[model samples]
Every structure is written in structure tokens, then in C-alpha cells.
Target: MKLILVVVLTTAIAAIGITLSLILSQRQAARDRALSIISGNKLQDATGKPSDKNDPNKRRAALARKLKESEQEEKDDKKKKEKGKSTMRELIQQAGFDFPVSYYYILSIVSAAAFTIGAFSLGFPRIVIAMISIIGFFGFPRLVLFLLTKRRQKKFLEDFADALEAMMRLLKAGMPMNEAVKMCAKEFEGPIGEEMSRIYELQKIGTPLGEAAVLVAKRMPIPEMRMFATGLLIQQQTGSSLSDILGNLAKVIRSRFQLKRKVKALSAEAKSSAGIIAAMPPLVALGLNTFNPGYIDIIFETRSGHIGLACFGLWMFTGMVIMWKMSNFKV
Candidate 1:
């Protein structure tokens, strides 16, 4: 039994050693292959040229040519990217109306049509139905558009500060201004990066940097962005260091973002109060109608009651509008 155990131990040890040796050999072979590729010592099989076979210098020269071709392909790709960007900017310009106007018109038309249909179907009083249509067509859609624009602008502003910081880092890393901008556009998501990408494209297509910057500012309609773009334009024209300019711009944007956040925090309570006040009347009425339908029905039982309800609705609307305006603070 002792002799058998000793033979088994020896066999297992030998097997383990062989496996380790194989692994080491494989790793060494991989390393050698990689080093050969890096040193341009590896060559394709030479069937056509007898002199090229086994020639290290020929292999190195072939590798050099391959590298040059790869570099040219990279340059071509960059040019194509720039061209695509310029085309998109041109399309945006050709669309003519800004987003806000386009959104407002479409919403207003839809709202007007809906209200007209609803009014006719419900046999609502002529005056009340007319007021509804008028509000839907003229007032409500504009309000919706204004709210959406403000929200979108706020989101863009928040994103812009971070994008600026990213651009600063890329600039510090020795990237050119346009390349840094392109990197930011590619790395970040949403409107801020999207707008910068558009500008980068425009610059590639021979649009003066200043003109492209101005166009971006106009499209965004943000003061901070306008200032940033103007700074870039001036830097480009005057041969200033873009890295330092971008760094400073990044700092300023972050400060503005901090200040805006502080303002929003301070205004939170007032905004909540306005929202609650605006919402309370409708919610309380809803509860009363649900719990005591007979009590609420008296208001609609008489002609005078109908007139009172209409006036009350107008008053409630006015109050809500006032509250909404008071709560809105531009950052």
C-alpha cells in the first residue's frame, strides 16, 4: 500500500508540472507574438515577391505603409463627421421657426379643434363654449409652450456646466478647441452637447467659427451659452489660449449652477405654497362632489347658479395665473 501511494503522488506531481510548463510556454509565445507585431517584424506570406521573403526591412516598410493608410482613414472619418454635422445645422436653419413657436402653433391648433368638438358635442352654452375655444386656441397653448421651453432650458443649463468642465479637461489634455468640443458632444447626452456638436460640424464646413457660435447661441437662446460662445469667438479671432478661456468658462458656469441651485432651494417653499393654493380649490370641490353630490348639485340647478359658477371659474383661473407668475423665477 505504501509503494502504491508513493507512485500515485509522483504521477500527480509530474502531471501538475507539465500543465504549468505548458501554460508558461503559451504565455511566452503570446508575448513574443505581440512584440513581433509591435516591432513590425511580422510579415504576410510572400507568394509574389521572392526578395520580400525573410526580409525584415521589407516587413518594416510594409508595416509603415499600413500605419500611414490607417492614419489617412482616421483623417477621412473626421472629415466625414464634420460634414454630417454641417448638414444637420443647415437642416435646422432651413426649418425656419424656433422650437417654441413650432410647438405652440401645433398645440394651439390641436387644442382649438378638440375644444370645438367637445363644445358642440356637449351642447354647452354658446358664451361658455366660445370662451373655452378662445382660451384653448390663444392662451393655453402659449402657456404650455412657455412652460415646456422653460423646463427644457433649465435642463440644458444644468447639463451645460458639466459639459464645460469636460471640455476644460480635454483642453488641458492637449486637444484642440474643436476636438475638445467634439469630444464633449460625443461624451455627453442631450441638448447642450447636441448644440455643441452642431457648431463643431458647422466649423468644419467653412462656416466662420464666430458665425457658428452665434448660430448655436441663437438656437439655445440662453445668456450663459451666448457668453461662452462669444468668448470662444473672441479667443479664436485674437489668438488667445483656448485652454485657459475654457477653464475659466467652466468655473463660471459651475458657479452659476451653484447659485441657481441655491435660488431654487430658497424658492422651494414659496413654489409649494403656490401649487397647494392653486390645487386646493379644485380638489376640495371634487371631494365635496364625491361625498355630497346633492349639496354640490344646487350650484348647477339654477340659471343664476350657472352664471356664478362661470364667474367663479374665471376668478379661479386668474388667481392660479397670478400665483404661477409669482412663483416663476428666472435663473
Candidate 2:
């Protein structure tokens, strides 16, 4: 009994010593955790190395970087959207339409409404009227704009060559670069003078010559204008004979114009053939309707007839588009 009591007492003291050591280690660990949080440092492990995986500071920094990147991406997306929107507006402006976009929308709506009423008054079915209205609203406006834009671009191209020639002449006469541009603007008429005056005005406002050239190039988007702008900027940056460069560019422009005319002349027969093919069915139907009343009325008079006409129209448009594409030859 006395030996058992001695062993029990020794075991109790050992257990107490172990418990005290554990409590002291727990308190030390708590103090270390507090200091780590305060100093913005990672908690060190038993090997005396910082554990980045479990570090709050590192996690916070990573999150901050991600947030910054996301913000930058949003800004870039916004810029792209704005640029696209502005590009369309610029095209409309370049086409010489000074009206607001809302004007076109209102015009389209009014046109659709008027066409629907007109078609209904002509005893057309609802589906036929709908088709007519859609064509009036969308197709007509687009066709008009397309024609106008092409005409304006053609006029610009014709005048641009002359302007380049005039610039070369002025440069040969020993006029300063800016003065030469001003003289060209005053000497020309139509789109060339207008565009050159715009460039001169931009220069007056302290826009750099290269930036001004780039702006006009983007506005017109013609290869000759782009080449001219690039050549001028390059020659301005390096020492080069401005007159010689302008004269060569003018010659190239005239050659390209001549080539374009030749191509158009060569393709005229194909274009005329396609147009005749596309127009034959409608023209024949009109002739038949005139000679034999109600002969073509079945096309839009009954539901089956409406469906047939729809399919026929679709195929006819497809064939016409194919022929048009085949007739086109790029320079």
C-alpha cells in the first residue's frame, strides 16, 4: 500500500507539469496570432517560414488586384461601346445627313404606318401589307442612304486627286506646308475644299499634323487619302521632297481612278444582264395584269397565294443577290 501511494503521487505531479506547459504554449500562440494580425505579417510555422496560403494580407492583396483588373476591363468595354456608337454617327454625318438619329427612327415609323394604310386601301391582305410596310420602312431608307453615300464618296474621290495635284503645285511654288494646305482648300470646290478647310481649321486649333491626318483618314476611309496622310506625316518627320511625294501620290491616285473606270466599264454588261434578269418576272407580271385584269391578283388575294408569293419573293431576292455579288469586281 505505501509503494502504490508513492507511484500515484509521482504520476499526478508529472500530469500537472504537462498541463502547465500546454497552457503556457496556448497563451504564447494567442499572443503570436495577435501580433501577426497587428503587423500585417503571416503566421510562422514550426519551421520558422511564413505561410502565405493562410495569410490574410496576401489574400487581401490578391482580391484587390482582381478587383482592379475587373474595373479596368469594364472601362475598356465602355470605351469600345462608345467608339462603335460614334463610328455609326460619323458615317451618317459623312453621308451628309445633319439630322439627329431620332429623326431617322421617326421617319421609319411614319413610313411604315403610311405604307400599311396605303396597302390596305388598295385591298391588299394583312400579310401583304405587312411586307410592304417593312420594305418601305427599312429597305427604302437604307437604299436611299446607300446611294447618297456612294455619290458623296465618288465626288470626294474626284476632288481629292485634284486637291493633291494643287497641293503639289503650291509646294513646288515654295509655299510653306500649312500655307499650301490653305491654298488648296481655297482653290477647290465641293467635298475636297470642305474637307481641307476642316483640316486647316483643326490645325488652327493646335491639333498635331499627324493626328489631323489620321482624323481625316478615318472619316473618309479611302486608301488614297490614307496613303496621302501617311506619306505627309512620314515626310514631315523625315527630310523628304514634299513636292515629289505629292506628285507621285497624285499620279497613283489618277491611275487607280482610271483602273476603276475601266473595271466598271468592263463589268457594265454583266450588271445590266443581272438587273434585267431580276426585273423580268415583275415586269412580265405587270404586263400580264395590264392586258388581262385579275391575272396577277391571285398572288396576294388568297392565303395560299400569299404563301406562294412569299416563297417566290424570297427565292427571287436570293437569286438577285447572288447575281449582284457575282457581278461585283473589286479594284
Candidate 3:
């Protein structure tokens, strides 16, 4: 029994270690690529880009003023609901999934059943099995949903600047803003395309371009998307050069992306150290359990030992959260 338990624990640890290593390596590679790009090229000027406006400076200044007013409006609008949590339906929509809310409940039920079966097979106490079932039902599925939503948002941001540039091109070709958005809907793939298509549909049904943009921004709730929406609103109100505004917005988004990459690269050492520190307790416990199983059996057999283990786990989780919040920079 000890041998089997040791093997399972080792396998789980190895799997986690391998996954973390792969994630770190990927981030390093991306950082190197971003640094190379940053070193090789300069950020393009907004005014240097192709523009139909004869007086670029005047239009730029006018757009800047309009943006300031729009920013204030946005702040006012967000203040009322800044702390509100999204509903499950909103989360599903943000993740770009078409599934109904009932699907989530079904998944939770399945997960709970699986977890309960596993705990029973392992001969855990009834109370312990119930707790695990509750976690599987309420915690695991919700966590997965949040992760999916975040990943979708990240993918959307990756393609968003390109989408904006494409829109600029279409706009410069003398297409109206709504028509350019419609063209982008067909041109791009994935999240950007789906969002653009939604915007186009909204516009087709008589929603104003600015209103359609706002809907997309509200759905995404990312800074880049919000900026795009704000620019559209400003353009609609002031008749500013939409192409130039989009061009500049794309540049800004790219710059922010590069900065985020640089920050991630710089923080790699700290992240590595944190990972090592976090693994130490588990590794040590595993070693002790392997060589002297009696010493660790108390943790599994006694009520006090169980409480101690629970407290240790709670503290470890708290520490991990604190470290994550500290290391996480919102770029």
C-alpha cells in the first residue's frame, strides 16, 4: 500500500513539475522573441502612417481632446458597477462558448460523481468524501470556466491589434466604419472575427457604430478593446479620422504587449525561486513518508493530524496567493 501510494504521489509531482517547466520555457522563448523584435524595430508614429487628413496635427489634437472627454464618461459609467461579478452566462459568453448554463450544472454533477467515486475507492471517511464532492461540484468547474474565459480574452488580445490595423486599411480605402467592421468580421478568424461579426450584426439591426463597439468592449472588458470602443465613440461624436485613431491605438496595444513580455522575462528568476520554495514542503513530506511511513501515517489516521494537515494546506494556499498577487503586474 505504501509503495503504491508513493508511486502515485511521485507521478503527480513529476507531472506538475513537467507542466511548470514547459510553461516557463515557453514564456522564456516568447520573451526572447519580443525582446528581439523590440531591439530590431522602432515604434511607428501615428502621424507617419497613411492618413487622408491634410492637417494631421490638428486632427490628432482634436481627437486627443475628444478622447479625454470619452475617458471621463467611461470612468463615470464604470464606477457604478466596477466591483460587480459577472454572471455565469456572461462568463460563458466572454469565453466565446455557445453552451447553455445547464451544461455547467451537468459538468459539475459529473465531476462530483467522479470525485465521490474516487474518494470512496480510496477508502476516505464519509465526511471527507462529501467535502471532496462539494469541491468537485462547486469549485473545480467554476475554476475551469474562469480559466477558459481568461484564455479566450488573451487570445482575443493577441489578434486584436491586427484586427484594428485591418480596419484602418479598410477605412482608408473609403469604406464607412460599419462596413470596415463588417469586412474585418469576414477577414479575421477566432475571437476577433466572432466579435466583429457580432458588432456588424448589431449595426445591421440599426445600432450605431459606437454603440456596437461599446457592446463588444463590454463583452471583452480588456483595456485594448475598451480603447477601441472609446476611439469609435470619440470619432462618432467629433468626426475625427477613424483610420488614424485606430492606427495609433494598435501601436499603443503592441507597445503594451511588448512591455508585458519584458516584465515577464525580468520576473522569471523570482517565479522560479517561488516555485522551488512552494515545492519544498511537499517534497520533504513525500521523502519522509517514503522512508518512514509510520511518521506520516498519523496525518492520515488521526483527527489532530488531519486538522494540522488542513491548516498547513490552508496556509500554503494563502502564501501562494500572496506571492502570486505580488508578482502579478497588471500591464
Candidate 4:
């Protein structure tokens, strides 16, 4: 048990240290790349004689600046929306739950009570039981919420392009944007259907189509969803062809989905290795306790041993989180 604890702690600390170093290195590399790009652009501009209004370099610089401005505006908009809503409410909405936030509180209370009772029945020490209860109350519910939100988002993304194509076909059939959205709400199922229904409902309640799209984007907060909303907003403002915009957006989404799959496939081996490495210490300890009697008693019987075990578990959790973040690609 002692050996297992030490191994887990050492591995976790080392993994965390490595993760931090990699993050710092990546940031520094990004900064260097940005600086290099800026310097290269400046050098090219200096070497070239001032050209007419059709200068490609100037056009490129202006485009880049506009892109940056648009990105900053999007960021500010997201921040404002986030700030206006409660985090828990947003999480619940993302998880597809329509219950009030009070339900979450009730669920947490029940979880904490159940955990406390189970720990007591198992003969755990008071401090250990308290820690478990606290985790049940706070950590477990949030973890569940995160998992649900992620699963819902993944499902939405998987079917999103298809939804867009459906909507595009409706538009091409001479249906107005509102009718197309309403048809999508009825035609699809799962996250896409639910979100489309929401948008349709908002529109029915006298909300502008653009505002409804914005609200849907706010709820989902995914890039693809935002792109869809932006497309709607642009079409409304500029009188562009909605069918063409939806078709292009659908293509882009499909491309992004393909890239994500490729990245996940490439990272599968690393993720599997991390999972195995993380499970080994606990499995070894369980084996020792089962086959070699009293091998883990020290960890349960002594306060100092218990503290060490807790620290070991905490670090192990930290390491797993860091590894998960490392393996996950935002694209």
C-alpha cells in the first residue's frame, strides 16, 4: 500500500510538472511565431515600393486587421452573455435540462447525505467521511453536468451539418427563413431538434430571427453554432442568399468534423496509455490488499497514512485532468 501510494504521488507530480512545462513552451512558441509573422510582414512592406490601391500586401494587412476586430467583437459578445447568466443555469441548459437550479441543490444534498451514510456504514473515519461528503456535494454533480454538456454538444455537432443541409433545402424550395427554421425544428431530433425548436419558439413569441439565432448560439456556445447564427445575422443585414450561406457553412462544419476525427484517431493511443497508467496503481493496491492480507491496513488505520493517501489521490486526479486537457483538441 505504501509503495503504491508513493508511486501514484510521484507519477502525478511528475505528470503535472511536465504538463505545466509543455503549456509554457507552447505559449512561448506561439508568441515567437506571432512576432516572426509580424516582422516578416513589416520587412516585406519596407522592401516594396508604395503601390497603388490594389497593393496585395496592404489588402492582406487590412483583411487581417478586420478579422482580428471581428474576433475581438465575438469575444466581447460572449463575455457579455456569460456575465449576464449564472454559470449553473448555463450548465443546466447545456446539459439539456429544463429543471430549475433548485433541483440541482436538492440533488447535491441527497448525494451528500447518501455518501455520508455510506461512508459511516463502511466504518470510515469522520474526517474521511466528511471529505467524501463534500466531494459528493460539490464535485460529483458538477462532473456529471460537464459530462452531459459535452455529450450533448458532441451529438449536436455530429448532426449539425445535416440539419444545415435540411434547412438549406427548405430555403432553396422558396421557404422563408422562419419557415425553414420551423421545418428544421420538426424534421430533426436530439440536440439539433431541441435547439431549432427553441429558436422557432422564440421567433413565435415575436423575437427577431436574428435575436433568436443569437440566443441559440448563446445557449450552445460552440463555434459551429455561432457560425450558423452569424450567417443568419449577416443574411438579415446584407440581404445575402441564405441557401448559399447555409450550404457553405455545412461544408465547413463537415470539414471541421473530419479534422476532429482525424485528430482523435491520432491521439487515441496516447489517451489509452494514460488511462492504463492511471489505473495501474489502484489495481496493484487492490491486489495487494486482497492477496496479501493487511497490506493496505496502514493507509486506513493511521491518520498520517490516511492524509498521505488523500494527497496521493488528489495529485492523481490532478494528473488525469492535466492529461485530459492535453489530449483534447479544441478544433
Candidate number achieving the greatest lDDT relative to the actual structure = 4
How would you encode candidate 2's per-residue C-alpha lDDT over 258-331 as one tens digit per residue?
88899888889999998888889899998999999997788878866765675567567656655665566444
lDDT of 1 by residue, 144-239 (tens): 556665666777888887887787788778887788778888987777767888989998998977678777765666657755765565555444
| TM-score of each predicted structure versus truth | 0.55, 0.64, 0.72, 0.72
Cα lDDT for residue 199, model 2? 85
Spell out the clash pairs found in candidate 2. Answer: none
Error of 3 at 242 (Å): 0.9
lDDT values for all models: 0.66, 0.70, 0.76, 0.79
Sort the candidates on lDDT, descending order.
Answer: 4, 3, 2, 1
Clashes of each: 0, 0, 0, 0
Tell me how far candidate 1 lies from the true structure as C-alpha RMSD in angstroms. 28.1
Candidate 2: residue 14 lDDT (0-100): 59
Instruction: Give model 4's clash tally.
Output: 0
Write candidate 4's Cα lDDT for 73-148 as tens digits: 6688678677865778878898999899999999999999998999999999999999999999999999999999
Worst 10 residues of 3 by lDDT: 35-44
Off by over 4 Å in 4: 1-85, 293-322
Model 2 error, position 243 (Å): 2.2
